[model samples]
Target chain A: MSLHHQIRQYLLDQAQMHGWLAHAKIPSERELQTKFHASRITIRDGLTKLESQGFIYRVNRKGWFISPPRLLWDPCHRVNFYQQARDQGMQPETEVVSVNPLYDAPLIRHQFGMDYGNNLELLRLRRLDGRPVMVERIYLRQTDFPGLAQQPLDGSITELFANKYQVQINHESSHILVCGTQSEEAALLGIPEGTACLHIERKRYDANDRLVDYNLEYWRQDALELKVSSRK
Target chain B: MSLHHQIRQYLLDQAQMHGWLAHAKIPSERELQTKFHASRITIRDGLTKLESQGFIYRVNRKGWFISPPRLLWDPCHRVNFYQQARDQGMQPETEVVSVNPLYDAPLIRHQFGMDYGNNLELLRLRRLDGRPVMVERIYLRQTDFPGLAQQPLDGSITELFANKYQVQINHESSHILVCGTQSEEAALLGIPEGTACLHIERKRYDANDRLVDYNLEYWRQDALELKVSSRK
Candidate 1:
């Protein structure tokens, strides 16, 4: 094995023994360099390997830390983001950035099968374990859920639809892609602009086969690797 | 819209009308700067936007080019790569790198439900329109397909299995991820190492519901953004 590989294995073994938690800082670069008797470049190469494999992540000017395990998301499942994170042992928080009535959105209009009417637009920021993980822009037909603005918005929209409106979502479809983080999303997610993100365009249908909502979500790619399948 | 946005739109509109093919180089940076009457940085920002959206890809020394459209791959689908690409209006080619018999592979051994026996390992490169798109390392049970080494391996292995070996695949499951390119894979895919890649691990089962094969595949993230759906 190369020196770099040895350095990677050393850090990994130590991390395992340390029972490393998410965002737990690792040793400094100089520390690794002195301990391994290797150059800074060699230590960085080893750290790069760990980052690529999703074992650890580097925060600019902060240091390297243990990465949170990926949250398994199933579009077909009824579970929402808050519930999913809770099930995975992460504290999930939702910050409702904005919700307003919009009369003109071409794509959402087409998806909702609307000819003329208004839709509610929602910009939400979601965090897991105090780290910003995703931002979602959701669109829903305003008339479908009247008085939606009266409901508490900083929570799972899925649960809101289910319990408050008695609207059950029976079908969903997701289109996943790799996308660059634009400036606004960059600020909200605390990542640099143009970072790769796991972009998911999801649509939900009611039991009557009516389109209930559609959302474009961008998830931070540093730690999450969503393994999606067609069935259980 | 920003000047960069205008430049990106200009190039995109032109590509659509021109029927841009994969690897078709766009205008040089200088040319774009002159045409847009913008600074080189502005021109590059536009190009970066296009690249991030999977509309174009860059070569190390060569300029940017229109990226090939992403292939829609379904693990639940019975179609193979060669067939799927062909059906999607692409000239697909497969190169069999090597096939070696291995006695010890812990992961493959577990996937195959085997306590004892050797596995045949295959390394293959697949291309779309002469561009290296994916490289797969496959592992199969040696006893499952006797005389597999003698079979013609350059084309579709699925065809070979059905016709020559009388083995038909009925099921497959895939685990997808985002990974960074390593040095060796970078050379094969003709991209810089540490480039983000879409990685997939797939397992195949025969009609008898026995695990027949397992493979790890790395896809260049330049142009392709696979949209996976879980249903028919």
Candidate 2:
């Protein structure tokens, strides 16, 4: 292996073992170049590869810092984000931000097949590990919950659907896209304005194949990734 | 329904029917306000909601544009980009750009258990419709196909594996993540620098569970979306 590669691996292993990826800082390119007797280009190349592979991130003109490994999600299966995190041995928690009843607008009414003036409850929260990664705002039919917003605001939304409402979430279809963060989203995600984000709009259908909830999740681009596979 | 919402639906319908997504300009905020006969605040609210929901993208100086839809993919099943596009009723094509034989690096060699100096043939291409959308580079064991680089590289990679190498791709694993386009990537995908992309690295295994091929695919973000379901 090349000296530059050797140094890169050494830094990666140290960071991984330290368990301080979210804030661990590594040596500067000049420092690495001097220590390894390598060219600046070689050091930069090693760092570039590591950054592209989701190992670390750069802030401004400052040197690199170890970034937390992204959560890998299998897109082919019907798994939600919280469960996927737990399955990968990470703690999943949701903080309820607010809940309110909203009246149906024409566009939302059309999408949800609700009549005019039909009231729906909107539940908003930030889902996180020990730290926040994504913000979720869910809109559900009020008739299905029958005062769900008044209940406890913690715990899994899926469990709330099953145990409290007796609704089985059989399947859901999600649409994922990328966009620059907006002011509201940026404030919630704690990222800068115009930082890229993975936006997911999901309409979940119940066992009877009825659209039960419309949920939106905005994921921090540097922190999470979704993976999917298909049969050849 | 509120007048503002009625206007929102009208704009969305126009966007959908005309495919007026990202890069395609829309009526100005002032024009929308005049046409909808709604207050500027109301129009701004609707536009803000659309932008927040990923249905539109806004520029600092420029106004909003309809957001492009992403290609939804299921990762658990083995499916290719071509198939995913076809399922969405869109035309898809793959162009073979280059093929060559090269030495396998230590990482590559260890991953595939290959010997040093063993030549590995790689086929590189850009998958496109009327324009390039994804770049796929596939590497194979040279001994499996002595003349693969010289053969006419068309059709599916799986078919090539089956017909020439007599290998059945029975199973595979894939890793997906986000990537920012590099210079070479930009030249191939015909996109500007800093374009967000989906990076998928996959290794296919044969029926005997032996690794046969390793592929790296960079998909244009505007062209694809992924969906995963969560079972509660």
- As a whole number from 0 to 100, the lDDT of residue A16 in candidate 1 is 85
User: CAPRI verdict on model 2?
Assistant: acceptable
Give the TM-score of candidate 2 (chain A): 0.69
| Top candidate when judged by TM-score against the true structure | 1
Tens digits of per-residue lDDT for model 1, A1-232: 7665676678678878988767889899999989989888778766755664566766666788877788766554446777878888989999988898987778778887744479899999998898888899999988878999888999888888989889977777777777777888877887556656778888887777788888888987664666554332
lDDT, model 2, position A120: 67
Model 2 chain B: lowest-lDDT 10 consecutive positions:
B121-130
CA lDDT, every model vs. true structure: 0.76, 0.67
> Per-residue alpha-carbon lDDT of model 2 for B1-232, expressed as tens digits?
6443565588878878987655577788899888888778677656654553455545445676665555667655556667877787666777777776666366666767743346564545554335456787777777777777777676677877788778888877777677766656666766544445677788888877778888878876655676655543
What are the candidates' C-alpha RMSDs?
4.6, 9.3
lDDT of 2 by residue, A187-225 (tens): 665654545567778888877878888877777666677
Q: Which stretches of candidate 2 lie over 4 Å from their true place?
A: A1-20, A25-66, A75-91, A114-123, A127-130, A229-232, B1-91, B113-123, B127-130, B163-166, B190-195, B227-232
Q: DockQ, in order, for the candidates?
A: 0.33, 0.26
